[model samples]
Target: MGVFTYENEVASVIPLTKFFKAFIIDADNLYPKIVPNQPQTEIVEGDGGPGTIKKITFNHGGQVKIIMHRLDIVDEASLTYKYTVLEGDLISDTIDQIVKEIKVTAGPDGGSILKNTSIYHIKGDNQLDKEKLKTDEEKGLTLFKIAAGYLLTNPDEYN
Candidate 1:
């Protein structure tokens, strides 16, 4: 198998605690509320902590797609979250798995900085589409903005 890693950083005006709470701690609850055509998420195994498995069902394009994720780490004090895509339509014949790590820290100007690393494990010597990966990265950033906007509108949330 071959592996590829992609790293991205996004700065948010929201505070570290609030951002972390909304984005990482309460993501399963918050995502469906903030995103359009809300995705359905359920805990399939284990507690909400490490080793838990989550199933997410969402509509992509005109088709329904499901994704399963296994939580590797969920640290609240350090504001770090990690998960690996275990199965579903997101995984193609060329891809075996995708592991994602996210860390939120206090940024300058009283905001927060979110750093994300995606490690893709490919099957055999297959290669991934760079453009598709870039688009996925942009979508991830858009999710951050969506959460920030939701928090901005609802001041009492994730406080």
Candidate 2:
């Protein structure tokens, strides 16, 4: 297994309360709209609460679609959400197993930090390439930061 971590910090013009709600509550619903470049994410089954599950269809830049089912979700607090990928095209098609989590926390002064962690279990039954995974994860983090920064500016009308 290999682990990758990525992070970004943003200064929010919006208040913390509104920022948190937009990020934790509204973002999931508006993700597909806000990130039109990505695949469609549908909540096949979920409680809208901790331990809830859902199915996410990830569309790649090449229009390749991968359906991923949620394994677990833990609402640690007001703005932190942790989840794992149970099943998906990326898992069955490419990798054997994967675990991804995102943590949102209030920054020291007045902003927030969105950190991403991705753990991968390669399928080849051989040693994993940590550097390659880290590079890919870094690229993902860059995109995430851009998306998140956009959300901070425009929480509504994500659709």
Candidate 3:
């Protein structure tokens, strides 16, 4: 088996508390609402807390796929959230699962620093491409930034 990990840090001008509240706490409800022409998405189950098995569906070119994620931890005091992708088209035959953890902290200029760590577990003797994974992660980050931007402009939207 092979294990690969990637970590990234993003600094934003938004306050830490606001960023966490919008991106972490209210993401499920806020994401699809803010994005324009976004694919049909829904949280098929759970209360958006720990142990919640939430399934998000994505449709592209008439092909629909569902990704199941189980929330592992949600630490409000520490501003940390962790989840694992249980099933998805993103998971390859050689890949077992993906665990993602996000933490928000105060930045030097009173903004926020978002820290993300992703661990990919692979099947035996399988070598996965890291560049593709990085691209996917970057896409997610962009979407997150879009959500953050919406929250910044419409302060009362997610609150």
> All models: lDDT?
0.89, 0.57, 0.81
Instruction: At residue 55, give the lDDT of candidate 1.
Output: 95
User: Which residue runs of candidate 3 sit more than 4 Å off their true CA positions?
Assistant: 38-47, 60-64
Can you give the lDDT of residue 72 in candidate 2?
56
Using alpha carbons, what is the TM-score of model 2?
0.68
Quote the lDDT for 105 in model 2.
64
RMSD to the true structure for each prediction, in A, is 1.4, 4.0, 2.3
Ranking by TM-score: 1, 3, 2
Q: How well is each residue in 1-159 modelled by candidate 3, as lDDT tens digits? A: 789999998888888888888888877677676765454545667776688888777654432267788899999899999999988876779889999999999998888999999999998899878897798788778876887688778877644
Give per-residue lDDT, candidate 2, residue 68: 58
lDDT of 2: 0.57
Q: For candidate 1, what is the lDDT?
A: 0.89
lDDT of each residue in 1-159, candidate 2, tens digit only: 333343434444444555556655665665665566655656667666655666766655543356454645545465555666667555544466676666666666765666555666665555655676665566655545555667656756333
Q: After superposition, how far is residue 117 of candidate 2 from its true place, in Å?
A: 2.4
The residue-by-residue lDDT of candidate 1 on 41-143, one tens digit each, is: 9899998889999999885453337889999998889999999999997689998999999999899898999999999999999989988888877787988
Q: Once model 2 is optimally superposed onto the true structure by TM-score, how far is the C-alpha of residue 99 displaced, in angstroms? A: 2.1
